[model samples]
Target: MKLVLDHIGVRVGRSMHLDDISLTLEPGSFNLLLGPTLAGKTSLLRLMAGLDHPTSGKIRIDGRDVTSLGVRGRSVAMVYQQFVNYPSFTVYENIASPLRLGRRLSAAEIDRKVLAVAEMMHIDKLLDRLPGELSGGQQQRTAIARALVKEADLLLLDEPLVNLDYKLREEMRAEMREIFARHTTTVVYATTEPQEALLLGGQAAVLDAGRLIQFGATLDVYHRPASVRVGEIFSDPPMNLLAVAIERRGSGVVRLSPDLSFPLPSHMRALPPGPCRLGVRASHVALAPSSPADIAIPATVELAEISGSETFIHGRHNDLAIVAHTAGVHSYRIGETVALHLDPQRLFAFDADGRLIAAPERQPGTVSGAA
Candidate 1:
């Protein structure tokens, strides 16, 4: 089912929930709705699912206007962050309920379909257990199983893995990707996590303050953000933004700061000298070497957090608080002073109005760079 939201708007009393949002979701493709809390991700999903009415615009599926259709009239299934399951029914029965609704399916066929989805969800061993008897992860798996077993044409998952533990969330993300790849359903997933959006790569629609900021292929959106706000939203540690004045010299030298400057890239020399914002990702910030880059700055380390295979170093550079992501285990004490290197080629420059003025060249397999 190809779903389209044509200039949809939702207003509740005096508050506007969504404002003139427009998007088209291709059939059998995974679409990611990304935003922060109260950014209207859920409200937009509800509009598509017919759980709420849009105050204006229209909703269409495959060229047919379904704006008037209620939830019961649509072939859709939704899974929420909080697991929703029948407390009285066992896992097997819960998954089979949708298949048995107003249809005559033999017990053998029902069992086959139910068990298939249960195994796919890694909850086959808990088939006879009730919701109360299962762990939080298991219970959520049961809810997901129930939703997938129906084989609905449209699947809406609203942070379905958010309730799981860290390890379980990682495991389930990979599993869900595999399951979705095998099915041809049009899946729409809403998430506030930038990593999750990248992990479930497809198309992405970024929302902010009930407005659709940008939408396109996930990698394209990440690499070529439309604005500074979009770049900040799509970054994990958040993009490091710095206020700087650009000074263009006749010799092609561009000064970014009083003490920092480098030869401007061939394409950037055309920019007029003025004030702009520089955006750099944490991964692009590196520890100073004996022979550092020309744009190195002295900074004092404030904090260091080591997790898994990376260390996040937070420090202060002049008046700016900067974060650097480095691979492997590293230790840094508070008050330690270190020089940081900034690669001009990997930097992004935004105009005074927060519009992207320059973007770094695209490189494969590099998710952390200018946008």
Candidate 2:
């Protein structure tokens, strides 16, 4: 079933939880919603599932207006991070409870349907086990099996993999994608993890402070962010933002910072600017052993972190703290003086209002000092 949210807003007590959010989910499409805490990602899911009524606007399912419909009236099912299962019931009983309690089905039919979903979820061996006996992952799979056995039209997952370890999370992530692909259920997924968003959903919607920031294809939103906030959201090390003043020098030449100067790109030369923020991803910044004349800035490494597959080096330039990430291993040490160079061509500037500005053109005769 296709799900459409139009101007949906939810208010709890005096505070607004979701504000004028709008999205349309194509049938069988996986839509990922991401945000920080209090961003209303889960609130939107609850509204879509008919668990909570919107204070304003409408929610439509398959062209039918279901804004005021109750949870049971809408064919939507939700599986939350905390697996909701009956402690006293066995796995078979938990999976069969929905059918027994809500729908009219014969004993033989309920058993057949329960067995089918159990097999599909790989939880057949745990049919006789209670919820407490199963591991967290197994319990979650049972909850998912309960939903699928009912053949829900819309599947709402609220950070279903959030509690698992990295390895189990990865394994369940693949399982979820495969199950959704086979069943073709309209799905709305909510998560704070950017990697999970990109891995599960073809399209992603970013929410900030209860407002919808941007929504589009995952690659489009990641590579070309609409604003500085959008750029800072998806990346691992986060986007580096620096405050600088833009000054025009010698006709069309523009001085971005006091020490760093370059000619403005043809498009940016016409803009009026005073104070601007430069946004660059951590991967775009590099360190050079020898300081180049024009592009490199002197910095002192304050700290370095070495993970299994990546290394993060934290350094300071003037009053700004910057971080750079590299794969595998790095040789930088704390208190070492390093020359940091930013890729000017890949550098992005945003005005005080958070609007992105085009990078200036590279100098014709000058070569880039660092990679």
Using lDDT, give the best candidate's number.
Answer: 1
- List per-prediction Cα lDDT, in the order shown: 0.86, 0.79
| lDDT per residue as tens, model 2, 127-174 | 999999999999999999988887788888889999887888999888
Work out the TM-score per prediction.
Answer: 0.93, 0.85
**True-structure RMSD, every candidate:** 2.3, 5.0
- Could you say which candidate leads in TM-score? 1
| Model 1: residues with Cα > 4 Å off, grouped in runs | 251-254, 289-294, 368-371
Kindly list the per-residue Cα lDDT of model 1 for residues 1-371, writing each as its tens digit: 99999999999999889999999999999999988889999998898888988999999999999998998888888999998999999999999999999679899999999989999998999989899999989999999899999999899999998989989998888888999999999999999888888888989999999999999999888877888988889987888888877776664565545676677765466577878788888888888542434367778999999988789899887777888888889999999998777777777878999988888888776664321
Estimate candidate 2's alpha-carbon lDDT, on a 0 to 1 scale. 0.79
